[model samples]
Target: MRKVFITGTDTGVGKTLISSLLVKKFNAYYFKPIQTGSKEERDVNIVKNLTGLNGEYFLPEVYLLKEPLSPHLAAKRENKKIELKKIFCPQKEPLVVEGAGGVFVPLNENSFMLDLMQKFSLPVLVVARSTLGTINHTLLTLEALRQKKIDILGVILNGPLNLENKNAIEYYGKVKVLAEIPKLKTINSMGIEELLTNFNI
Candidate 1:
């Protein structure tokens, strides 16, 4: 199966927005491996609403925890343990898997978001905020992926355009800046279209 694992430098850096855009553009299946706080918010629903895709294109999460904390903590609160074996990609092509929070986020005591991506053996598309603190966050993220010897597709700079941050990330991290998305006041198709104009999927 063909897949692209979407991760961010930090939580709320717009991973979902990029994932949703890719899903909409490719009409690909979306999967969130370990989802916490499903009761409060669901990434699947967000993708559905954003992409306007049918339910079949969105897969149910492997682990669904109640609390909004990290997967490890959230699973502990529910008295459940996450097994990496339980997290498997669908036997289908053109799937876009969205990771929970940043790359180092814990899926269990030993496993992290990076481990999951490694297991999938797919190219990673990192979403980074184009604001302050992004240089360290993004470069560190790139370094982590490099240490693991994983394939990096590219980085997507989200939010307002910052040339310095963009150039620095590309040069220092030795990774291409695939795209940049403008800060959105809305998230409908038209707004998404404008934000995506900087680059294509």
Candidate 2:
């Protein structure tokens, strides 16, 4: 089965949004290794509402820390450690694995989100903002993935429509801008479907 690990240049950059769209398009299983803002099931709930995809599959971490902080710090505050092995139990379908925060965000003392990506041995789909400063962030993220020898499926640029950065990303970054999603005041399943079609998901 084909699997793609979805991550972002930073938090709130639309990793979840893109992941949900991919899952809906490909009818793939979804997994969130470590979530910190809400209950583990809450991530699945939001994705379900956003994608309108039904299945008996959705896996999140067992320790759902309430703090909206990095996983490592949240786990520390809760007096727990995130076991890497827990993130990689075998699944039966094609998967879209969502990562928390940026590539280097710590999940524990020695492991970061990228480490989890490595653990899964899945190609990455980077979700980035379409606004200012995205070029630097996107390039750096791509470089990091290159350093790790991770296969990058490409990047999805999210936010208000902006052609300048889009061209710059395509030209300078030397990576395909797989899709560009317009800023949405509210999101629905059809909207998600539109974005997926753009990406050929």
Candidate 3:
């Protein structure tokens, strides 16, 4: 199975958006390792809405946290510890693992999102905004992935408005831009079917 880790340059960079689309495209199982904020605001709901892949696809041990802060701080406030083992369980099909916030976001006092990714041992698919300053963030994220010896399965640049940002990321980062998704687009099953057809997934 083709398991992939989905992370973003920062929060609100559409990691859930791209991850849901990927789950539909590849017909893969979706897993959100750790989700903070309320249950309604979690990415698993969005993924379920988009893919209609049944409850089996969404794997999250701790569903809701009161605060929308980083997982570590939120867990601390709630007197809970983020369990890494629960997040690294095996899935029957290809798994699309979504990370909270950015690559370096803390999950505990000594562990971050990168540490979780390393534990999972999944290839990464970076979802970055297609705007100014994206190049810097993307590059830094790429370097972090490299340092951790994580396999990067290219990038998916969200919000396809800035051609310049896209060009810079491709030129400097030297990674394939797998897909450039525009903002405010409705990607249903049909759209996902088309993407799978095109990519021969």
Candidate 3, which ten residues in sequence have the lowest lDDT sum?
192-201
lDDT of 3 by residue, 1-201 (tens): 488889999999988877877788677888786778863476788778878888987776443576889999988889988877666546557888888999999888788899988998888999999888899999999999999999999988877568788888889888888877766556666655555565432
Model 1: worst 10 consecutive residues (lDDT sum): 192-201
**What is the C-alpha local distance difference test score of each model?**
0.89, 0.82, 0.81
Q: Residue-pair clashes per candidate, as listed?
A: 0, 0, 0
Query: Clashes in model 3: which pairs?
Result: none
lDDT of 2 at 22: 76
Error of 1 at 32 (Å): 0.6
User: What is the C-alpha local distance difference test score of candidate 3?
Assistant: 0.81
What does the lDDT come to for candidate 2? Answer: 0.82
lDDT by residue (1-201, candidate 2, tens digit) is 378889899998988888888778778788886889784345767788887777565765555777889999989988999878776734657888888889999989899988888888888989999999999999889989888989888888989888998888888778888888778777877778777666564
Estimate the TM-score of every prediction.
0.96, 0.91, 0.88
lDDT of 1 by residue, 102-191 (tens): 989997889998998899888999999999999999999999998998899999999998999999999999999988888889877776
